[model samples]
Target: MTTFTVPPVLEARAPAEARGVARDGVRLMVSRGTAVSHHRFTDLPGLLDPGDLLVVNNSATLPAAIETIDGVRVHVSTEQPDGTWLVEPRDFDAARPGLRLRVPSGSLTLLRPFTSRLWVAAADVPGGRVEYLTRHGRPIRYSYTDRDWPISTYQNAYATVPGSAEMPSAGRPLTGAVLSALAGRGVLVAPLTLHTGVASAEVDEPPYPEWFRVPSSTASLIGHVRRSGGRVIAVGTTVVRALETGTPEGWTDVVIGPDHPIRYVDGLLTGLHEPRASHLKMLTAVAGEEALRASYESALRERYLWHEFGDVHLLLR
Candidate 1:
C-alpha cells in the first residue's frame, strides 16, 4: 500500500460556514489516481459513461435527536432487535437514573442508564418496542446549522425506508434531478440498506456499529456490472460498508484499510472525512494509501469542505 502524505492544512477542520452549500449547491472534486479535478455536483452526469453503475445506500435517516426536560441532549445511536435503544446523551447528571421523555405524541419511560450517555428506554410506537432515546427532538442536524432542519432536508432525494440515524451524506448531493439524469443516460442505479449508527467523533469512543444488508438482487446486479465492464460507483462510505460487509460468503467485521482488497466497488463518491476517521481507512482500502493521501491533500488545497453536509469527492480508478 502506498503511503501518501497528508497536507498540514488538511489536518485543521474547515469552518462550518465553508462546509455549507455552494452556489450551484453540490461541490464536487474528482480524483483519478494521483491527479485531481473539480466540478459542480450538477456536472455528475457528464462525469460518467453510460454504462457505469451507481450503488446507493437507501437507508433513511430517523428522527433520533431528543431533548430531555432538564435540557440534557441525547442522540439515539442504534436500535436493538428487542426494541431497546443504544443512546448517547450529553450533560447527563448521574442523579437521574430514570427520566420521562416526551416524543411526537407520547412519553417514553427511560428504565436504566447504561453509561454516562447510553440508556435503555421503553416506548409505545405502532409496535411495542423499547425505543432508543436520544437528546434529539428531531433529526440529527450538522453542527453548522442553527435550527433543526427537517428530516427530509437530511435525506437524499432517492432515500427510501426510514432507518439510519443520520444521512449517508456522500449520497446527499444526488438530488432527484440528478437521479433522473443518470437514469436517462443509461447508468443503472441500485440500492442497499445500511442503517448508520452515529458519527465517529475524534476520540477514543468505540466505532459506531451499524446493521446492513445487500439483497440477492443487488449482489447479482453488482456481479452483472462487473461482468459487463461497468464500474460500480458506491455513493457513500455507508454503501461501501454495506457492499463490502455483505459479500456473498457472509457478513464481516472487516474494518477497511490498505490491507483489505475491495471485492465490489470500482469507484467511490463520498464526502471529505475528518482526520483519522475510519472511513478514510476504507478509502485507502479502495484507492491505496498513497492515492488516498494525494486526493485528501488536493481536497484540502482546493478547499473541499469536510464532514456531513460538506463537499464531495469522487475517486475513479
Candidate 2:
C-alpha cells in the first residue's frame, strides 16, 4: 500500500445551475502521477492511453420517492434485496408514526424507527418488479431543484439494471459520443453493478445498506489491467466500492475516509461532494489526503457545484 497524506479542503462555491447540466457537461480535472491538466468532459478519450481500461458501474437508479397516505412525502432511498426499505420522510410527524405508501403493483406500510431514517416494510413484487413499481411511483429526485423530475434526467446513457434509489452520478458525464470516441481511441470499457441507495441529505441520517455486484468478467478484466500495467479508471465512487469489495479479501462498514485502503482501482472520475460528506472520506482513501485536499480546495476556489447533478473531478495515479 502507498503512504497516504491528508489534503486540504476543497470548497464547492459554484451555483447549482452552473453544475447541473455539467453532470454530463462539466469540466474534468485529470492528474497523472504528478502531472495535472484541465479539460472538458468531451476530452476524456484524449486523456487515456490505448491500454487504459474504463470501468463503469451499470447499476440503474430506482425511483425511490413516494407519497404516503396522508400525502406526506417520503423518499425510500435504499431498498434491500430482501424487500425492506431505508426510508427518509420529509418532515415526518412522530405522532403519526407509520406511513403507508403506494407502489404501482401494490402498497407497503413503513414501520417506524428501524433507525433514524430507516424503516421496515414488506411488499410482494411478482417476478421481482419492485424496481418497476418504484419507477412508476415517481422519479427519484434531489431537493435542490424545483423542476419536475424526469427519469431520463437521473440516468446516464449507459445505465442498466434497476436498483439504486439515486443516480450513481459518477458516469453522468459519459455521453454516447464520448463513449464512441473512447472506443475509437482503443480505450477498453467494462461494466460492474453497485446499486446506490438514496443519498442521505447533509442533514439526514447516515448511510443505509445497499446491494452491489462485481461480475466475474469485470474482476478478470481488472486483474488483466493491473498485470499489464494499464490503469483501471473507475467511473465513480460506486464503481470504486464494487471494485474494492470484489478484492480477494476486503470489506467495508459503510464508513468513508482514509482508514480504508482501496485495492483494485488506480484512477477515479467522480463528482464534487459537499463539505463533511462521508463521500469525501472515500475520496481520501483513494486519492490520499494531500491530493484530495488540494483538488477539493481548487474545486472550491473554482466554484465547482456539489451534489449528483454537479461538476466532476478525476484523479489518476
Candidate 3:
C-alpha cells in the first residue's frame, strides 16, 4: 500500500465539542472518482441521494482501560471463546506469562502473549464484566488526546450494544439531528453489530478477528436496497467488514485492500486514517488508488483533523 507521513499538527488532540465545536460540526471531505470536495459533517444529508442505504455499526464503546496499582494501564480488547480476555499493557514492555496486575476490585493475570502487543488474561472482577468496567474503567486514551474525557465523550449518540474496545468513531459525527435529517430526506439507515477489538497503532498488522452480527433484518434490507438500484453506504469500515463477510454472525478476520474483492458496499463514510494503517487498504478497495491518494492529499492540504475525534471522509462510486 502507498503511504505518507502524517504531520503532528493535523492530529486532533481533543474532541470537537471540547474545542468549541459541535460533534457534527467537524469537516467532511468527499471523494468521488478523482474529484474531491469538502463540507461540514452536518451537510451530510444534502450530499447523498434518497434511495441510498446508510449502514451503521451499533456497537457501543467499552470503558475498557483500567489502571493497575502501579499505574500501568491495561486495555481490555475482547473476550475469547475460551472465556479469557485479550488485553494490552500500554507502555509496559516487561510483561510475561503469570504477571498479575491488580485493579480497583479486580485482578488480571496474563496467561500468555496473544500477539506481540496483546496478552490473553484471566479477569477476576467481583461484579460482572459490564458492572466492573462501569465502576472502574475509563475509555482508552492514546497520547494524542490532551486529557482524560468521560466514557460518554467517547460514545456515538446512536450506539446501543456495548462491546467495542474503542469507539467506532466514524459514526461519532452522526448526531440525532443528522439522523433526523437523513430520515426526512428519504435516505435509509440500517444497523449491524461488530464488537471491535483493540486497534493496533504500533504495528502494520492485519485486523484481528472480531465478533460481528448481521441481523436478518439488516441482511434483507441490504438485498432490497441493492435490487432497487440504491447504494449501500457503510457509515464506517467496521460496517463494511461486517457486510462483506457475507455471514449472519461470527468472528471475522477478513482483511480488505486492493487485492480483496468488495461485494456488498458501494460507498463509505469514515475518518482519516494514519499513514501505513491497514484501513488505508480497505479505503483503496472502495475509492481506488487514484481517488484515495487525491483525497488524502487534499485532506492534508486543507488541514482536516485526524483520529476518532476528528474530521470525516466520504468515498462514493
Q: For all candidates, what are the clash counts? A: 11, 12, 0
The candidate, 1 or 2, that scores higher on lDDT is 1
After superposition, which runs of candidate 2 have C-alpha atoms over 4 Å from their true positions? 1-24, 32-36, 95-106, 124-135, 201-206, 247-256
- By TM-score, the better pick of 1 and 3 is 3
Better of 1 and 2 by TM-score: 2
Where does the lowest 10-residue lDDT sum fall in candidate 2? 1-10
Q: Tell me the tens digit of each residue's lDDT in model 1 across 1-317.
A: 33344443443233233446542365788888888888888889889988899999887777777766556666776776676766666566553446666554455567777554566666644433213322234786555454656666677777776777777878877877888888888899998887777675323233455677787887898888899999999998878777777564333345666777888889999887766567777788878777887887777677766666567899987
lDDT by residue for model 2 (79-155), tens: 56565656666676552345456554566667656666656665543444354445455766554554565667777
Better of 1 and 3 by lDDT: 3
Report the C-alpha displacement of residue 257, candidate 3, in angstroms. 1.3
Q: Which whole-number lDDT from 0 to 100 does residue 77 have in model 2?
A: 62
lDDT of each: 0.71, 0.68, 0.91
Give per-model TM-scores. Answer: 0.81, 0.83, 0.97
Sort the predicted structures by lDDT, highest score first.
3, 1, 2
